[model samples]
Target chain A: MELVVFSLLNGVLYGLLLFMLSSGLTLIFSMMGVLNFAHASLFMLGAYLAYQIGRYTGFWPGLVLAPLIVGLLGAAIERWGLRTVHRFGHVAELLFTFGLALLIEEVVQLIWGRAPVPYTVPSSLDFAAFTLFGTTYPAYKVFMVLISIGMFGLLGLVLTKTRIGLIIQAALTHPDMVAALGHNVPRVFMLVFGVGSALAGLAGVIGGFALVTSPTMARTLGPIVFVVIVVGGLGSLTGAFVASLLIGIVQTFAVAIDFSLIDLLARFGVTVTRADTFYDLWRIKLAQLAPVLPYFMLVLMLIMRPRGLMGTRET
Target chain B: MPIIRRALLGVALTLAALPAAAQDSIKIGYIDPLSGAFANVGELGVHHFQFAMDRINAKGGVLGKKLELVPLDSKANPQDTQIALKKVIDDGIRFVLQGNGSNVAHAIVDTLSKHNEREPAKAVLFLNYAAVDPALTNDKCSFWHFRFDADADMKMEALTNYMAKQQGIKKVYLINQDYSFGKAVAAAAQAMMKQKRADVQIVGDELHPLGKVQDFSPYVAKIKASGADSVITGNWGNDLSLLVKAAKDAGLNVDWYTYYAGGLSTPAAIGQAGKDRVKQITEWHSNVEAAALDEELDAYKKKYNEDFYFLRTRNLMEMLVKAFEQAKSADPVKVGIALEGMKHQTPTGEVYMRADNHQLIQPLFVSTMSAGMKRDVENTGLGFKTDGRIEAKDTETPTTCKMKRPSA
Candidate 1:
């Protein structure tokens, strides 16, 4: 029971981190109708920028300045880079962003070398939060939960309560209709893209310290963020949040429980040996399956409901 | 046979473009990843060999021929390595050097052996400075391939020796990357633990996909639940760094006995997260004193703007030049033959090539991460200090290689 509780808490923290990444990509997907495949690369850039900035001015300044830099660059990309490719339709834009991801990884390697930077948590939040049943929960994990929840609350307030939020919502539903009403849809798209990139950058600043900030960080998080957003439904932040937590908890609990197919077969008196057909299958444990479970869920969701859980339109 | 023979001859003709002997420089082909995830580490290796070659050239060159180090980027891919080997041989290079990945190393060893068979006149020696897969020195060992560093099993043996004497390490866990190298490490550790300390409980044995895991918190949770007092892992690169980071974040302070803690960027990234708790076994450490090694190190840092990371290169460079001089030829086959059973006292201790398998037997050092060192990499506030030293004889293990040596 203690193990279950601990795992659940850990899973929530991981899910929150996923949402921080997925929320940004979801906004771009909804507003622009073209998935920004370079979202994770932007996240990686954020981490490297934070490391560089932190080296000079410390971690707090990096937390503020890194995302601002990423946001402005993202705006430039949307305004000039993606805008040019928009002529050839959404696929071309997607492809452009995909290519941009590869380019960013190379550029990062060129600048930082092909190894992880020594980015660390600040000393203030470096200690454990509290000990439960002799297991100490890291303060950084708690900090991650707080920051993610704060971002979620802020996003909700902006979307439901602000005039720009109303404009953004209208733009998401019908960009041409919003543009017809005298609001610049293209500028709105650029703004959404910039803010989305900033969110990803923020995730990187926090997540880089939690995980590893290598050239591979973007590739590592890219597919998984897509999984969260896809399972949640396109353009639905609430759905993305729920899906992220579900996947994170399932993966965490699955890994914690080391149940093997061989052990299950033994209960039925079907002992598997090396000579047995598909013995390798029996050797696999739930822990090994954790990384693939999200993809499996995606497949299941796609087959059952192509519109996705909270998706109002085709995606 | 004509079709196959023609195909082989066509390949040979295409690759035999460069003259074998040109001027007074003996060309050595250095093949490794130069532009990829492992490029940084591979670059480090390239510098080490370059530094060694520079030293050799200063000492009146190898047999009066100035040694030239030609780098061929393998990109750390097995398929790319085969082409890189062909390219090197075609470019008139007789000695090929590589060490980043075992997969690339295996491909080179097999391809070079076949190349040597087909084109004996253009035989190239494969001097491995780093890849420590036991198979390279075991069943797959070849006449053309020679490993300067100790293999994985030998590292585990030395590691277990140190672990056996350490008190309060009652419960141990084995965690490694889910690959051939990792599997070998776990198996070796299990067998050694059973042999040395039958009472030590192996609480948890886990393997994860290499380079795929982003979050290791769940894995660390499992380790803590298992009540493991000490953790043994063979994971390298980001896998090692992330695992150590996860442990630090969770406040699971346990000793990590590792093979690749000294890998590229690991020492710097982990920094105080390890806090003297991590230890690694290698041929030598910066703290280990040897005659004139300090001077060599100073020169290396001054030349490269980095601390010298490669230790076995001392053995590799010295032995290569010695073999070249002794054989009275720049020919690889002759040098390879002379390399076998050749004895030399490296800064660490006396090292010799086992004529049976072409495995270099050198002194091994068990080092700890602690503050204040004579030398450090990346100013990580912590550096490796030698804790225990084992001579070449004690670290030697039996090999299954029945090398097919050529007649003189």
Candidate 2:
């Protein structure tokens, strides 16, 4: 029972982190209609930038400044890089981002080398926050959860209450209609792109301290982020939020649970031994299956309900 | 008419003599991860060999001719490795160096063995540097291949024997990255524990996916609940760093966490946060005070702006050069015969390549991060000291290889 509760909490935190990264990707895809393959690379850049800034100015300054730097760079990329390629259509735009991802990876290797950088958690959050069922939870995790929720709330307000939020909502649903109403749709696209990339950068900043800031982190987290965005639906933030949280909890719970197929067979009084290929399936662990579960869920959802749970359109 | 005939005869004789004395340059191929996540380590390996080759040429060339190294990027993938190996073979390279990962090594070995059987004259010689999977030396042993590093069983035997002697070690938890290397290490550890330490109990065994796992809290919590005093793993690269960070964050009381591989010698992998949390075993260390190691260490540090821990490739290359020199030829068959049962001294220590298994028998160093070393150790000049060195033992175990030397 204690393990279950702890895993659930862990799952929620992990899911929230995924959401922070994926929400931006989903928003950008919905608005721009081009899947930015380099979104994860931008996240990696954010983490690397935070690691550098945090070394000199401390962690708190990194938390605020790194995302802004990433946002401005993202704006530049959208203006000069992606916009030029957009003339050739969405496939060309995607290819550009794909090339951009490759370049960013090389750039990271040139700057940081290939070894995993050891970005430490802040000393303030180094201590355990509280004890649950005789197990202490680190304060950094609670901070991660708080930051993720705070970012979600900030994004919610920006999408709901602000004038820019109203403009974005109009553009999201009907770009042509918004352009007819004298709103500069192209500038709006640029803002959304910049803001979306900033969100990815924010996730990277928190994630770098939370995990190892390695070049591989982008490759490792890239597909999972895409899965979350796609599973939650193409244009629905609420759907993305739900999907991220669900995928996280599922993966967390799956890894924690261990039950072999042999155990199931044993319950039915069936004894089979010395069979080849039995060892292969019996040796499968839940944790080993955790990484592929989200993709599996994504495939199932795509087949069963093309729009996803909260997706606005079939994508 | 007589003068013209004499001139034509002299020119024909000169052209014939040129083809006999000057042979084609011996091409050695290197295939490994060169452009991906594992690129730095792979590139370092490449650089070490290139540096060695430059020095060798400067002294005077090998076999009275210059060495041409042909490098192909594997990207640490088996498919890529297969393609690269085929390309090397097609380019008429007889000697190859690889083995970054077990899966890639296994694929290359299997393909090479098949090719060797079909065409004996085109047989390739392999020098495996860092792939430590035991099966490659045991069940998958090849006559044409030589493994320079310690295999999984050897490392596990050392680790388990050390753990058995230590007091206060009760329950052991086994966790590893779910792959060929990880599974092999875990199995070896388990077998060693059962055979050596009866008091030690294995509470839990788990495996996590490679590079796909971000949160290690569940696994940490499981370890805590299992009441294990020690945790044993074979995880390397990013997985090692991430697991240590997560385990520390979860307040898991790991009295001893033995790494079969990973962060064993690389300071970059462990960082400042992990210095106190883990102890590593490796082939070489920067602070090990040996007379033979000092000169090589100084040269490597001066050239590479980094410590000398990534010298496994250099050691392997030196061994290859020695074998070739001893054989007095670049022939794979003669080189293999010369290398078998060969004993040489390395910067690390004396190493013996066993005739039976072709696995290098060398000293293994166990080291811990130095206390009072500041976090800026990479920049501020701090180093690790060797706590123990396990010398080569004579507990002879039969290798799984059945083939005998073909009357060489």
Candidate 3:
């Protein structure tokens, strides 16, 4: 009972964190038809920047300032870097982002060195928020959930109800027409890209302490973020949200399961021994493969639906 | 035409100086991950080696020649280790040092075993300082390899013996990184615990991907549900720090028996939460009852501005130099023979190289993490306090290594 309840809570929290990053990615993909390979790198930069700023002015100031800095940097990249390569088609933009990711990683290493920094949860929220079934849920985790949900609500409001959000949505489908009507389509793209990056940066500030802030942070979480967006759907925010929650919950619960194929087979009359041909493969538990579960879901979703859980567009 | 001539001249000069460079100092190639995920660990090993080399080189040198270190990045992968081995052999280095991963050590031993037989004159000696997989000194032991650290079985034997004496430990959980070393640690812990304390129930056994896990709360939750009073884990680096941090956050109160909890950054990461609860088994720690070693460690920290871990490196280097002096030659074959059944006195006690397996038999210390220690790890104001010590004779486990020595 504790396993079920805690797994549900932890999984939901993890899913919310993934949504924070993937929503921005989905938004950027909708605005520009390019997959930003450097999205996670920007998230890593946000963590490092927050760690730096937090060293002086405490965690709260760093929380606000780091995302703003990252957002501006994202806007600058879109203006000076991506806009110049816009005419070269999507492949060129993809390659440019790929190179940018590598460059960012190297620059981070040069600046921070190759060690896990001491980016810890702030002392203010370091205590247990509450205990459920004798297991303490950290107050920091509660803060993370609140922040992610708040951002999601605000993002949804601006996108659906605001005039700029209307222009951005119209620009996504008919950019040429939006520009014909005197709307600054390029500026809209830049705004969307900047906002998307800022969202990722916000995720990093909290996720950094939740996980670890290291040189390899980008590389480790890069694939999972991509999985979240791709399995959520290419450019669908709703799809991203559902996919993040599904993957997060599934992966977390899977870690609690110690059953293997051998166990399932043994429930029947079948018995497998060490001398079996693929004993190693047969003996692997779902718990052991929790880290790889996200990628496995990605492959299954691609083969089965391709358009993702709630995606409208097939692409 | 000028550029081409200059390039040719550079190549010829490099080729001309290569042999002369080899003659000036006996170079021991240090092969480990100096880049990628395990760079910090690899770099730490390098610092230890460099410090040891400097100390040895200060004493009028070995065989009248200063020992030079040749660092080659292996990226902590077996395939990359093989590549580094090739580079070591090609560069005419007859001694190589490696440690971080047991899989990498396996690769080195396999490559050098073949290379030693195929080219006896250029055979390289493998000095392993840390990779403690029991298989290295057992079924997979090589004539070219010498392990300085205690094997997994020996440490587990010592650790479980200590745990058995503590009447409080009724239930134990085994969690380790999913790799050769981690598996060896788990197997040894289980086997030894059963032998020592048959009444103790093994509550949980889990293996997770090495260096990939970011959150260990789920694993901690399972341990909590299992009602384990203690956890024995072989996870190192970020995995170790993150696991302890997660457990502390969740208020999961269980004694942690770890192999690498005292490693770089772990003490700082765990902070005050780990005080008096975390224990580690190692050959030496900062707070051990050895005044000379404490002075040397203090000096090392002062010089490098980093905590001086890896006392095994000092032993390895000193033994290597002793072998070089006793043999009076740089040839790996002669040194290998000299190193067999060799004895050296450490600050704590005397250690010997077992001729049967080339595994070092050293005294192992079981220490508990405590606050208000004279020496702390990673500046956490918490350090290891020695609980008990297992002598070299007690640490002995029978080896299956039928080492095939080269014909004299």
Candidate 4:
């Protein structure tokens, strides 16, 4: 029971992290209609930036400043870089972002070298948050959960209760109609893109220390963010939230479970040996299945639901 | 009539000069992961090759002509590697240097072997510096390929033998990434255990999918519950770090021994927390002592501004240079022949390419991490102090590779 609870908590934290990055990606896709293949690279940039800033001035200041820098960079990218490529079409924009991703990775390596940077949790949050049935959870994890929830709440408030929020919602449903209504749709698009990118950057700042900041993080997390956005339904924020949480819980639960098909067979009085390759075939461990669970879920959802759990269209 | 004759002579000279220039320059192609997770390692290799070329050219170029390294990014994907390999071949490269993944190496070998089988005279010679799959040197051996690093079987034999001698390690848990390298390591370790000590029980054997694992709690929990005295893994990079961290978090008391520990086993990966939980067997550790190793490593660190992993690029560069010197010609055939049964001193110690398998025979180090150990005077992370050294004498007996080499 304690294991289940702990797993759920872990899932929630993981889900929030997925949301932090995926939310930005979804928003960018909705506003700009460009996938921004380098969204994860921007996150990686945020982490590296945070690491750099943290080296100069403590972790807290670095955390706040790094995301702002990333936000400004994102603004420039949308205003100048993406706009230049936008005229060429979405495919060209995607290719441009892909090239940008590669360039960013090389730049990161040039600055930080190839080694994994040792980004540690702040000393204040270094200790165990609390012990649960003899297992201690670290304080940094709790901090991550709290920060993610706080951000989600803030974003929810902004999107629901503001004039810009109404504009974004209208833009989501009818981009052309919203633009024709005399609003600066391009400026709104740019703002959303920047804000979304900043969220990814924020996630990176926390994740770099939470995990390890390395050049490989972009490659590792890039696909998952895409998966979350796709599985959550392309343009729905609510759908994204549901999908992110679902993926998180599903993956966490999968890793926590240990029963194999062979164990089930053993209960039915069947025994298997190492010489039997088929015996091991069904003996797949849950932990090994964690990574592919999201994709599997995505495939299933695509086939079964067509529209995501909270999606409006049959996409 | 005189003007026409002079024009014809000038055209003839220009054509003649082009062929001579092409013949003078030897193009050696290299395929490795230059853009993905392994890019840094691959970049290091490229840098080392360039460094060697610069040194070689400074001392009068090879065969009185310059040697050019044509590099193709494999992107660490097998399909990408195939494309890169084909591009290199199509570009008219006669010799190739391949990087260290078993599946990718096997693919390149198979492709080259088929080419050699069809046309033996124009066969491309392959020198593999990193792929350590034992089958590549054994049953799946190719005539065109040579491995510079010890195979998985060789390393496993040494590891299991050492484990058998240890008194406290009665039970073992084998956790490896689910791939060819992992399978080979597990098989070799299992075979060695059967031969050396039948009493040793393998409590748990698990395989995690490569590059997919984010959480390692389930594996760690199993390891703890299995009551294994020692754990052996063939995990590298982030997987290695995550596993070690998870195990520490679970407070598992088993001694962990990992092959391919890479940067994770280094001082930078573990910080102060990892000093107690992990011990690694690697080709190079800064703490391990050999003659002039300190000077060489210090020089490299000063040049690069970071610690090197395996010094794999340096090792490959040294071997290539030694082969060039021994052959006394840049001709692929001559260098291939000369590289067979050649010995050279390296930073690790004296290494020789066995005439049989063309695998490098060198000393391997088994270093243990300890708290308060320092790599340099500046104290980089919790350092890895050398607890034991697996000397050249301790290595497995040499086996003759019966595979025949295709004529170039």
For every model shown, what is its TM-score relative to the native structure?
Answer: 0.95, 0.91, 0.95, 0.85
lDDT string for model 3 (A54-160, tens) is: 99999999999998999999999999999999899889999999999999999998998777777888999899999888788889889988987887788778888
The iRMS of the candidates, in order, is 1.4, 2.3, 1.4, 2.7
Which rank order by DockQ, best down to worst? 1, 3, 2, 4
Best by lDDT: 3
Q: Which docking category, incorrect, acceptable, medium or high, applies to candidate 4?
A: acceptable
Tens digits of per-residue lDDT for model 4 on A69-178? 99888888989899889999978999999998998988998888776887766677777778655555677777777777777677778788998888987886787999
Backbone clashes in model 2: 0
Best prediction by DockQ: 1
- Order by lDDT, highest first: 3, 1, 2, 4
Candidates in order have lDDT scores of 0.87, 0.78, 0.88, 0.75
When candidate 4 is compared with the true two-chain complex, its DockQ is: 0.38
lDDT of 1 by residue, A1-315 (tens): 878987898788789989988888987887667788999999999999999999999889999999999999999999999989999998898899999999999999888877778888877778889887777777888888888888878887888899999999898778789899999988998999999899889888888888878898898889999888889997777888898899889988888988899999899998889898898788988898787888899999889886677876776
True contacts kept of each: 0.66, 0.80, 0.66, 0.34
TM-score of chain A of each: 0.97, 0.95, 0.97, 0.92
Q: DockQ of every model listed?
A: 0.69, 0.64, 0.64, 0.38
Candidate 4 clashing pairs?
B100-B130, B100-B131
Indicate whether candidate 2 or candidate 4 has the larger lDDT.
2
Stretches of candidate 1 exceeding 4 Å from the true structure:
B1-21
Docking outcome class, model 2? medium
